[model samples]
Target chain A: GQQVMQIPQYQHVQEGEDFTTYCNSSTTLSNIQWYKQRPGGHPVFLIQLVKSGEVKKQKRLTFQFGEAKKNSSLHITATQTTDVGTYFCAGPLKSGYALNFGKGTSLLVTP
Target chain B: EAEVAQSPRYKITEKSQAVAFWCDPISGHATLYWYRQILGQGPELLVQFQDESVVDDSQLPKDRFSAERLKGVDSTLKIQPAELGDSAMYLCASSFGEDSVYGYTFGSGTRLTVV
Candidate 1:
């Protein structure tokens, strides 16, 4: 069974602070996807990374896939109140049907 | 921007009662999935359907839970004789394709509480 683990189960920061969440997998993954869930809301797709050592950015958010494709990271620069939510990373195992999701990093940005 | 739709955003029932939730994915989407999210936890896949056929249901509690996507469109998830531990948010999502890269569009989810 494949499993994904995320570090820093919870993080709280003041506005204008930076936050980062790390995700690691027990098995190599073909691709990794990131999602964000607002408080009391369903998860929303953010981005996906396929290539090893790949890096992608959306505004102040930066995503990185490890060179081995077994880990990933999501970093937010100058967090805002709107960035408050749980961030999750998911990747497919060999089967490729259902994705294995990390426990998620809950971020809290205080103004 | 089409999004997945789910009904009965919240439900409260006594133990041993039967409960059902409905989900309608974005039109033209080929894959649908049902996930459960306990409080303070991430969503866990319960079942996945490729159109009208189930592709995976290993995590589903088949003894008490069942799901169907008949007609390759809307779907339903039912839990019979629900227990107190069944309290959680049931989420439905759909993807344009089965690939992980395509990601999924998720519905608001149904929060169930079995008292």
Candidate 2:
């Protein structure tokens, strides 16, 4: 019933270039979480945003939640080869047990 | 660091065969979830369990997919008459809480290839 869509399905950049991925949901979410999955690896938790228009930063990465709670974005400044992976944004399911994940934005950084 | 445990990191089965995957969540974690990720998509929920009780399984294909957490400590997912479309990575994740506030700790996942 609910859907989350991610923009820029794929991206490739130089080692020092910046990258951004956007996620939009069909329904308003109470909270949103970000995850990263390396090639041949499982999804790893990155960050979570709850408040309206909230922004959280971890090292070189920044996560932002839209004011309406229907969208979110992740930005990386000066990406590196190690930053190559698929980034997914997940919203809490209304029933409150599982998360609805966006398709994901795959980032490839070249040297 | 504690991590979720999954068995048989990979599986290859013939179409119309049966396959199963196992998972053991971190100690003391009450919530467990099963998700499937295709080649280029994010993980999608298949089922969720809370201490041996199923909280939801609406996305699971009941006709061919079944999951159980009998003791609430470990779980198993079975697919009968697996089809080519069932090829994907099956992920098992756990959280200390029932909601996303704590986020999830995912296992390496079982990559299935149906021939």
Best by lDDT: 2
Q: What digit string (tens of lDDT, one per residue) describes model 1 on residues A1-111?
A: 338999889999999999999999988888999999999998999999999999999999999999999999999999999999999998876564877778899999999
Give the range where candidate 1 chain A is weakest over 10 consecutive residues by summed lDDT: A92-101
DockQ for candidate 1, please give it: 0.70
Off by over 4 Å in 1: none
List residue ranges in candidate 2 displaced over 4 A. none
True contacts kept of each: 0.67, 0.78
What is candidate 1's TM-score against the reference? 0.97
lDDT of 1: 0.92
**Cα distance off (Å), candidate 2, residue B73:** 0.8
lDDT by residue for model 2 (A1-111), tens: 439999999999999999999999988888999999998888999988999999999999999999999999999999999999999999875856689899899999999
Give the alpha carbon lDDT tens digit for every residue of B1-115 in model 2: 9999999899999999999999999999999999999999888999999999998999999999999999999999999999999999999999986555669999999999999
Count of backbone clashes, every candidate in sequence? 0, 0
